[model samples]
Target: MKKIAQFFLKPTVPVVTINGQITEKSVIELEKNLKDIRVSTAKALAVVVNSPGGSPTQSKKMVDLIHNFAHDNHLTVYTFAEDLAASAGFQVLISGDKVFADQQSTLGSIGSITNFMNVKELILNQGIEIRSVTTNPASVTNQSMFKDVPEELRHVYENMLQSQHKKFIDLVEEQRGSKIKVPKEKRGSLLYNGDVFNGKQALEYGLIDSIGRVQDVMKEEFPKADVVFPQKPSISGKFMEYAKLYNLFQTIYQK
Candidate 1:
């Protein structure tokens, strides 16, 4: 009876959560979790994402890490977004072989930006004198609040942002491939304009594969397998709770 029951038991699908901001610290924690999951007996992996996005470089690192994990373990990867997945979050979402999101889930925002505030006037008004002893004053002042950004420096920053934006677009094109319904030329204006969308709009724009809740979709897609979270849910739970509190306060303040 024991042998028979054992033989009937199905493999488990391990899940990883990517909630809140994606930073170097968060990616490091993920690396540790993946290292543990690498030795697991599961044949498939799932990622639950709910993030407004952060740190483009770290986001790419996350995508690469997950993709390598799938390759190394020969595991099928499924990604689901519950509330939000924008910008860097969307980058990580593309790592999945199949992506799912709730009907109300927010997705996309394929663009790049860098902001620096100039406080030269403020400091001057405060009667503070600032000096740069460096050989190249531009180097010290380019991004410093103590000095104004030169036109050439502003141009340089613009070019850098454009370059990053192009790379982001290219990544989406490469990953989604034929699944993306948007024409190549029109993608820039339509999909890469830093705008977000709901699941239905995402599907129409070819940003996601489907609109469905995580648990329901998991049951349907992997009926014989039990969904297992490889890491503790406390971290993600805390993040979501904090996010809710912040939003609540914002609403109250606005009202």
Candidate 2:
């Protein structure tokens, strides 16, 4: 009698969580999981994303990598939003072969942003005088946040933002397969101002396809396939669990 060949199978859908700031590590882990799925006995892939977006560079890299992987493997990639998916998160969604959002899930606000806080007032309140000398006159103004911002740097920043804004619009147009209409006045950096929309509203605005749960879609598409979660114990969850245990230990010691 011939020996039977044992076949191992893997889940097609891998839910990746992007709760906090997106980092290089998050990108690496996502790539690793996708690679594993490619070699495994899985026909397709799905990523359940819940993110507020992060570094623009990292977000772009992640989106490109996912797009390439799906194309090479001929795998259908689906992205299902949970709770929230905005900014860089939206970028990743565009890479999906099919994008979905729940009835209550929030999406949209496709844009880029950078934030900086001025500490000059705090130092001045402390009676601290800070002085700096620069070889270039422009450098002096650039180095200090206390003084009014220089027009040149402001123009440069605005230009960079405008370019990014255009790229975002282009991506949306490509993914949606239609031109999105936005007023000329609202076309700049104000594109993503942390606005959240329900599924119906999102569809009206051409932000997403349909309003349905992930499980329902899976059952309809892959009736016989099993769902899988690639990475376990999200960073935030692990941290909270550890904190709870530590608190328990402290209470016991005090008693």
Candidate 3:
């Protein structure tokens, strides 16, 4: 009788959190949780994102995976922004079946960026002499801390940045169905400048559907249904774990 009753009941939405940098490890963890939910219950999945964005490749991969999972399982995927979801975070939001941003939550800055450091002055200031032997001339010639950056590396990075920027534009165009004219100058490497916009402005910019809360979405989409948050680690704990991993990796590589 109990087993028969289970057949008629739908499972609860599986909730996953994205609080920090979306790296390979983070994506894997999310995929695992989604898989568990798929196995345990035949229900929809909800992902809560509060991120400043990170690792474009990782973001794209995660979004692709989530989209595929929803298609395969015939499940609806919803995303709710708690505080902020910028840059690559926007990609994940677009992948959702329905996306909701908190009324005061921030979103947008749909772009990409890479950081580079110039350390020549610091080394010279310390009176440190460096010598290198490399099989390739370009390898040694391309590496510099004080001198002008090699044009080749600059072009390579620029090209990569432009490609990512185009990808972001494409995603937004596909999801929002609005034509946003991004000026040539604004489409450069500084596209992902970690900017935040309120929900009202986000809607104006066509970055999100409407200005509303997560509960509002649940009420509209799953009325008369129970909303559930799966058992999972808190966002703070996840961030701490990531910090530890980053520190360990830094220590090993620095040594």
Candidate 4:
């Protein structure tokens, strides 16, 4: 009787994996997969994320894409943070209607960062000098890696980072809302100060809805639905994977 019921239901849930850095190429591929899912008979979408986070702009696009798809199709978005989901990755994680993570998964690190290096001394030691002329030398002078950032220019950078940081905080507050345990006034000093939490702690802080593997949680959330994951790699892809492993082993033995 149960088997007959399952056969008649025919529920399917399409899964999308967002791995590694969130770059232009990865975002484009994600959009393509979502487009395919948009037309499918599936009623829900599962996103598996394992990323240390990269490219804030790309991450924004990814979050927007998933949110738009969920809204348009009226499908539930289930996100699972595997291994690591920090910074921009966490931004994407919150896009899900329900989020899950492994007990040891690393999450959070909500903040903005910009790095600059002044190589003037290093080049000077090598007795090499680089010179260029531009229409607005004063405006571009402190912005160059060869020159130290002036106090005024530093303020500009700080303002930019603050703007970005505020955006991240707003998104979190909008999604998690009362789920966040941190007090309102102290949320800035506590939650949004670029700190990472393990899955257990993340659950306590209400960053994730639950702590479970994607497969297990999907079964519990949508029991009758058949979870359809992405296709396996082609023959050439498998060969490349093996070749990469072989190279790693050779390097390790040599070392």
Candidate 5:
């Protein structure tokens, strides 16, 4: 019976969901599940995304993995922007062999951001002994969030962000290839100045193939293949928030 079931059953097209803000832990779970599909009975993969985006570095890492999987394994990869695929979400979306967006989906925001709080006065008033210790001057300049950040440190950080943004543009251009048609407003700014667009605008800018649904996308790629979604790995969402807050406090208060 098992053999008959196996023999008669059709191949499945797995759908991987990328919802919420992307994070390192989330990407780890995504990669592990993707690898399972890569080795399982799935023939094609459809990625359904509804995200406002997150860390650029993490998004780029995911893009490389997805693109490599499709390229090296000779498989079809489709990415569907459900509602929102902004910033880092769009970065990952372009890696697919075919990318689509829902009619009302939002896209774009090609930029990077960093937040730092200068607590020098707060510590001085509290008489806190915040010892700034580091072996390397460069590391101190870049990582040490003590007092006000120096102009040199700001320059270095800005340069780092600019480099990442350029890489993003290059990747999008390579993937879309003469399809990008961003309006004048979205252009002529540092990192495209994090501009956003609706699905129609995104498609005009060659950011997506068409406005479509995940089910339709799967049917286009796999015809009558059954849908197979990998079991989502357990990730403690609330715990991660607490851990992140704790880490931020440590960075701010630790001597």
Candidate 6:
């Protein structure tokens, strides 16, 4: 009881938590922490994540930062996704020098999704009109899409998603090239069409290095490290809504 009390009273190892949706701001903060030479003091750096994913742009920025930080600081970095880490979140999870996850954790969604609503009819029904000013046909092609979206617009948008998806695939291949193998038939596609998996599947797919809790793994790897929380990812739904709304309007409407 006395030793347990002492353990509670002591400061633990520094474990940075990247636990929410990946956004520009999230990447900014994470990069800031990584840039901190303070990480050099820790025996090993650990990142814990649980997210449904967000912007691909932010995911790439974060993945780059993770790579750069570990290399520059020579700190062994460990990443974890507990419960869930899909889409952009999965990209970040695999960025770890070594990745971990809970046995039942959901992982992977190595694809891009740009969801939108065709509300032009709804607005017209209410007698509301959205006027726009644009310079050219290409410019208006995107902004004029609040209602009936065109096949051309859909095609272009799909191209954009494919472009981003290609990058996602490239990153996975780069990070876990040796550990993962895609059956010949599934090449040029996600591990399973944006479907997430349990830890065992993730490990088999080479999405993670192992399946274990941060505390247990860190205790064994960095016994004397000062475990602390540099920061944590805030789990929320507002960012996902914003991504869809902003991307939809930006790609489909011009004004």
Top candidate by TM-score: 1
lDDT of 2 by residue, 36-151 (tens): 55224355667777888887788888888777876776678888788888777877775677888887887776766665456888888999887766666454245466655567
By TM-score, the better pick of 3 and 5 is 5
lDDT of each: 0.81, 0.67, 0.69, 0.83, 0.74, 0.73
Residue 179 CA error for candidate 1 (Å)? Answer: 0.9
Tens digits of per-residue lDDT, candidate 5, 1-255, equal: 333323444667877888888889768978887876623346767888788989877887787777777677566898889888888898878778778988788888877777777878887889886776666545534455447777767777788889987877776668775666665455546226688888888777677888888887677767878766866434685466457656765876885
- Candidate 3: which stretches are off by over 4 Å? 1-11, 38-43, 133-148, 178-196, 232-255
Q: Give Cα distance to truth, residue 249, candidate 4, Å.
A: 56
lDDT of 1 at 204: 87
Query: RMSDs, each prediction?
Result: 13.4, 12.4, 13.6, 12.5, 15.0, 16.2
Over all chains combined, what TM-score does candidate 5 have?
A: 0.74
Enumerate residue pairs that collide in model 2: none
Model 5: lDDT to the true structure: 0.74
Quote the lDDT for 244 in model 3.
Answer: 62
TM-score of each: 0.82, 0.74, 0.74, 0.82, 0.74, 0.77
lDDT of 6 by residue, 227-249 (tens): 67664323454366346556755
Instruction: Give the lowest summed-lDDT range of ten residues in model 4.
Output: 1-10
Tell me the tens digit of each residue's lDDT in model 1 across 16-115.
8898999999799788888765234466788888998999999988988888988887878899888999989998887799988888898998888778
Which scores higher on lDDT, 2 or 5?
A: 5
Model 6 is weakest, by summed lDDT over 10 consecutive residues, at 2-11
